[model samples]
Target chain A: MMKILLLLISFPVFAQDFTGCGEYKFKGILKYDEKAPLKMSYLVREGTGSQMTFSLVNKSDVITLAPFIDKPSQFKAKIVKLMDGTKGELRTPMEIGLRFPDPMSASDTGIEKIKSVKCQ
Target chain B: MKATKPFVLPIFLLCLSFSVGHAAEGSKQFYFLGGGGEPEGETTIFDGEVKRVGSFINSSGWNSTVSFNGGHSKTEDLIKSKMGKAKNAGTFSEKNYNDLMNEIIQKLEKGELKSGDQLLISIDTHGAKRSAGKDAEKTHRVALAHSTATELNNLSGARTVDLDKLEKIINLAAEKNVKLGILDFSCYSGNLLNLHNDKVCLISASGPEQYSYATTAVSLGFFTFSYPITFGSKFFDNMKKGKSLEELFIDSRTTGDTPDFPMINTKEGLAINEMMYRFLTPYLNYNYSSTNNFSAGYVRRGDKFEEQVCRMESSHSDFLKLLKQMEEAAAVANESGREEFQNLREALEEYRKYQRGYEETLRQKFDVEKEIKDIFKKQFPNDQKAWEAYAPLDFLSLNLDSSITYYEGLAERDKGKKYFSGMWDSTVAQLKKQKEISEYVKANLSQNGLDKLKAQDEAFAKSGVTYKLSSRISAEAKKVYEALYNKNKSAESNPCRDFVL
Candidate 1:
């Protein structure tokens, strides 16, 4: 009886479920060297939607997106370069892929929402 | 032979039973490893102003100084005495440190320490970019610091361990089936919680980019001392009798000068103790509270309001009515008669601006949400779902900066959604009149307004929806109205405007 009571009382305090469900979209600047194999960026997405896309834009210059279409989600061409003339793509590890790709896209429309990009 | 056999069998059975029971119960182990040492002879400047400094200097001693007298004789004496004590203290030499760590690993592998057991490893050392060079090499452990998630799992030994040894060690004590909490007072301690786990609860003194300091006046660092002080003796006395981890952490942040100490836990909503929540809620209830301290409070208040006002579908017709009023006001301004027409036009323009501001606010919020999502994706490649539920509203409310007045209109139409309707509705109404919303957006978005607007446009295109407004307007009107409404709504919801109250 004592053991059961203790368990009951301690239940709410200890019980917790940490699982990521639903959908979310997030965004942040790529923090790593653009030329590096992997670039670090932050992103946020919310709601239940069939597609999500991430894009990067430089405050100043415009670069072409033709050379950077390999994995747009992982890496993308900067429309413009910083005043210093350093050119790089926003990229992270490609192994992870789109975290929550729309299941329907694969089965129905065959459209991949995430892609890679490079600047000419 | 018969007599001997009977006794031996009974003993064997009893021994087997004991071993099995022990195995079933699992192991309980807690590990803490952290220290900071700068071998290049660091300087400690003692100001003559504070007594606390005097005590610290006296207790720990300065570079070569023994006492405040600045006498060379005493300095040499103190150094010699301390050196002798240090040698005798048996701090980890290379051989010993490895041996101790290996022994812990061996125990874990042997299942001597089972799952649901506690393991706390704390490091109070300088973080280095690399595990080489002077200060970096002596204070750093390349294997411990750079160990991958797989490596941690291999050494953990138990079927259900409390701590997940991913890129960072997550404290599993607050979660179900485990009772453990780890405190790493180092600069990047918050990174530990970045690992994907809803079960674990983490409290970091500072974010990864920031540094954590321990003042001379306090025996422990700000976070370290605050935990014990706020939670009181109960934490130590029974562990179970103390406030929940969430409560203790909330109190610590609220009471200190800490910035928005990001708390990521799996437990849905504010899992803090009721008493603590009640206590902290009032401090945040005031309109003029500082943004740094009260942002978390607003989040909590918003969450509370959400609970009261259960999710409403598109059926609440009052939302349409309010939108119609605004639309009518716009139309009247477009085609009016006389002298007060200018005043009316200005008000309509203000209202239109408010709408645009609201949309912009949503777009900005989405940007923040996207940034957070990207951060999580980078951090937890394997467990994206853990970050998904972490803050549902952070993403849910991204494009949902609707006027409180609008929400109230919905509440009035549907009584069921009026749980704490009055509170939030009134606050929103006040904000609408005060131009707080517009000011907040201008202040925060001054640096990145254009980029944010473009992102909003892109978000709309990608989502296949041009505007987030009442479904009453035509698709084209909704798009235009959304842009206008967001601008004005942001003006009304500005924190500074609300703070004026």
Candidate 2:
């Protein structure tokens, strides 16, 4: 019950759909385990975005997001829990921006909008 | 037509001599009105600026407007009362903009304008872009034209200033030892960095390749609402007080209005230009931004990510050849610049290795998507309705909670470990900022009205699926990235790499 309540409390802060199921289900992109090496593990997308049709690699440091297109395109995103339950990736734990295709990001088609979920 | 040719040169000379005859006559500023006109929703801001600026000039005894022509502006009546149109336009065209610029340049060259004299231009029109340089994909350009003769939609007949030509003219004006300031409240205005200099200051509403706009609440250009220097702010008062161009630009950035980042050029902007030119010359379009400290980054796309990478691959190859010629042709002043160049060289050299691997990963992803489609077809190939539902490429549609966890897992490993430090420090800073902002922009702002999705988070977390196919895809991507970077190689391509045959 306490664990469930903790997840419930953390949902708003996490944003993307990161639920605690297995290791594959809990870690955030660019978010490293404090116990892990500084930059030994991260996932890079195979195709255009973090589409379900992807494969995750455990041995890279860069986490590139999807590029923008000509029209009102859509993509899936999720919130991730960081090491220590906060952002501590790439040596800047204080920087909390974790969403993909930033609304503030530039494009010709106005501001690109994104939807995200976080790890519980 | 042929008969009239003999008179053309003499007439041109006569006009040149005639234009040179009129000096600035000790005018303090050359305030001009332009950007032609806008549509119904956007017209109000242009109209408001005209009335306000025109009134300010008229009320002041300086009486220093070059000529105000709103060009079929709804507020034409107000313009006549104050500015006394020198040349009225049914609608402003690119020709009109060019003519105005020509007149200003002619005046500057001949007018004997001295130090502290100003040539001020304000642009509030539709923006467009075109190719730059010998290779179309390698270089890009920004133009603040489309000062139309009619509605913006009737673009075939409209005239807009060519950015290349505008840059040359603006820079020429700068060379006259006169102060030049431009307030371009249009899209792609920031990309016109060639016009940047101490003698000139430009405030663009949006960065390069970005669309600039206002909120649903009103159609005011983002710069209009900005503090201190904006139209709604103390524009006239600030002008009278002699605010420097730099101060006005800084003030504008402090209260950035649109979702798009506004840009101002300083020495830092020169650095930003380097990153934009060197790092971003590969693609025709991508989402990117710059910081006051010269940091800039472009977002990666899943759809055409490969194409952009491929561009960088080929462009990087050509760039190495140019770098090789540098010692013979040119030399960077600082030793550090050389060192930095070496590092960058190493990074570029390493590109094709991972690029080829990324291609493999993409093929695997497509193959997986194809497999999912095939599975659905085999299960219910006869049912057309079912096929339609499964048509979209959502191979494994996990619940919102599951989606979050999976992404987090990927991100957790990402850590943005640098494969090499060949890129500039500012470039690295920008890449980091882009990733952070990308996530931050989504989390803080209101998302696509999906309250329904949030409610599903808790219940859906329990329905996590572990497909064998998904794992296989993950393994493929892992191999590709592992070859490129790890935490251990964190010095950022330190020893430097030069692509040897």
Candidate 3:
């Protein structure tokens, strides 16, 4: 089971949300929604996601995704509402993307990050 | 719909007999996914409705899938803020939600789903009215949380899950013979009736055209902790103990102050849904707390449904009364603090008005003194006699300025002397009393409502608006007093006082 750590940063007006990285073999990309704006996606060898899947852990605690995430990655790096302080919001339509620094490991990081691997 | 068939009646047609029980070989998978996508909505829900999604979040019986849109996190930070870290929390975004649905679909296709497998996807998010497909029940659109990662898809608009798209995933599950139940807690959630089928049973917070509500008191939407039910039956609490989701919904619908929005009384919870009561809610032994109150629901609850399940036949009558006492004590303390804050605000405003008048009158007096001096000089160039006569008039003018009163007798001499010099020694006294009482209530209150009330009080303290305003007033009042002292001292020696007019 791969555990992905979420490192947080807060928006000026909103609560803090963390970003995490893990190492995964760059499996090939797949189609999620052909019609929606962000349709192309990729897969992590260890995950069960049809397109791609990952799980998040915050600080030292592993909460909420208790069932699905305790095993191999089977969930997406979940998105949160990022507000447009000027307007009302800015939306990130569902799309799967992955990247990692060189030498990513199962200790400091999780698996080989499905990094910079373009969809065929 | 799966190739193999079973002799079971459709779910909507009165659930037939109690065909579902613990005997099922398959596991009951429950996913409590969602919170308002927006930060405002997230804060409103994460504390109440979303937190209660713990029916199986921590349980070993049913497999729980937990995801949240907002908190200090994707997981409910309210728990993290009070307790410590939580377990296996996931994030909520349109992409993630779709992925989850797809995962389920994949599971069913792989024959991973068994005949007895039951899947309950409980959702709570903000909603908006939108035009959906022809076959769609209504235009209820869920405002799904967007990923904060501005990397891939940065569309500048509201984020909504395509109901039509979500419906496709649900229908596929149904076709695969998966028993899919949807419990939607969003405004106009009933539009999910579009998902209605033999394998699916849908429950919503309100009808397609209606709006849902939440309360600071309950920290929940009206549906969960609504007034129509006796003291509001918590849906998940009942689900925790063996009550079915359908039963909990019926209990809330029939008993809520429905057909109308819940009117919150600091003393008593007001009313609930009408059309809902006549239809599916059947009847629970409960009564009205007020008129025009039957059309609403809450995201929170006063009593656990299981506690009342045993109490239904025997001790249901005292349920509201008991809840009322608990609510009243809590309500009064919090309400009093807020009420006093408002009262103090008004009092300060009134005081400022007087201050403006006092300053204006002083300015006018100064003008009069200059005008008199000018007139005397213009009439008699260097005439010392004329200047002396004008001095007595200047003294009288200064007296008049001191005597000026904007609010009847509440003049500067009395006013400045009153709040600043004496009387009303404690500014915002009522607010102070309420705050003190709130501190006491927060310290001594029982476990049931204390945390929430304390949170509110803590938030109030953190805002510090009241104290900030009071301190500003105190500083401004001191300025007024200093001006009055100088005016009085100057009045004592008017230079022409001895030259009586």
Which candidate achieves the best TM-score against the true structure? 2
Task: Give candidate 3's whole-model lDDT.
Answer: 0.36
Q: Which candidate leads in lDDT?
A: 2
Which 10 successive residues of model 2 chain B have the least lDDT summed?
A: B492-501
What range of 10 consecutive residues in model 2 chain A has the weakest lDDT sum? A3-12
Can you write out model 2's per-residue Cα lDDT over B1-501, one digit (the tens) per residue?
Answer: 457688899999999887885453334454554433233322333444455556556654342543333434444565666555333432344565567666666777675555445556655544543332233221122222233323111122233344445565466756765556666655555665545655566666555554444221132555333122332223332343334544444333433222233455554444434533344322212212211100112222335556765675777677676544542232543222333344435544443443344345443444444444454455535532322322123212312233334444444444474432222232234334434433432343233212323433332232122112222222222221222222112432210110000
Query: B1-501, model 3: which lDDT tens digit per residue?
Result: 565344434553345344443343465677666654454333443344444445335543566666666434423555443222233345667767787778767777776775546777766666544342233324355656552322111112345564555576567666775666676655555566655554555666554443443322232345433121211224443445445544455334423222212111101111122212222111211112211011111101123323433343233234224334533554665533233223323435543343333333333433443444454455435543212322222122122221222112322334555433222122123223323432443344345333433443353233323323333333332232222222223323211111110
Q: Considering only chain A, what is the TM-score of each predicted structure?
A: 0.17, 0.19, 0.20
List where candidate 1 sits over 4 angstroms from the true fold: A1-120, B1-29, B37-105, B115-117, B126-178, B196-201, B207-213, B217-253, B260-501
| DockQ, every prediction | 0.04, 0.02, 0.01
Q: Chain B in candidate 2 has what TM-score?
A: 0.45
- For each candidate, the alpha-carbon lDDT, in order, equals 0.29, 0.37, 0.36
Q: Which has the higher DockQ value, candidate number 2 or candidate number 3? A: 2
**For all candidates listed, what's the TM-score of chain B alone?**
0.29, 0.45, 0.41
lDDT of 1 by residue, A1-120 (tens): 011000000000011111122112222122222333221222211111112222333311011111112212221122221212112222222212122122111111111223223323
The model with the greatest DockQ is: 1
- Greater TM-score among 1 and 2 belongs to 2
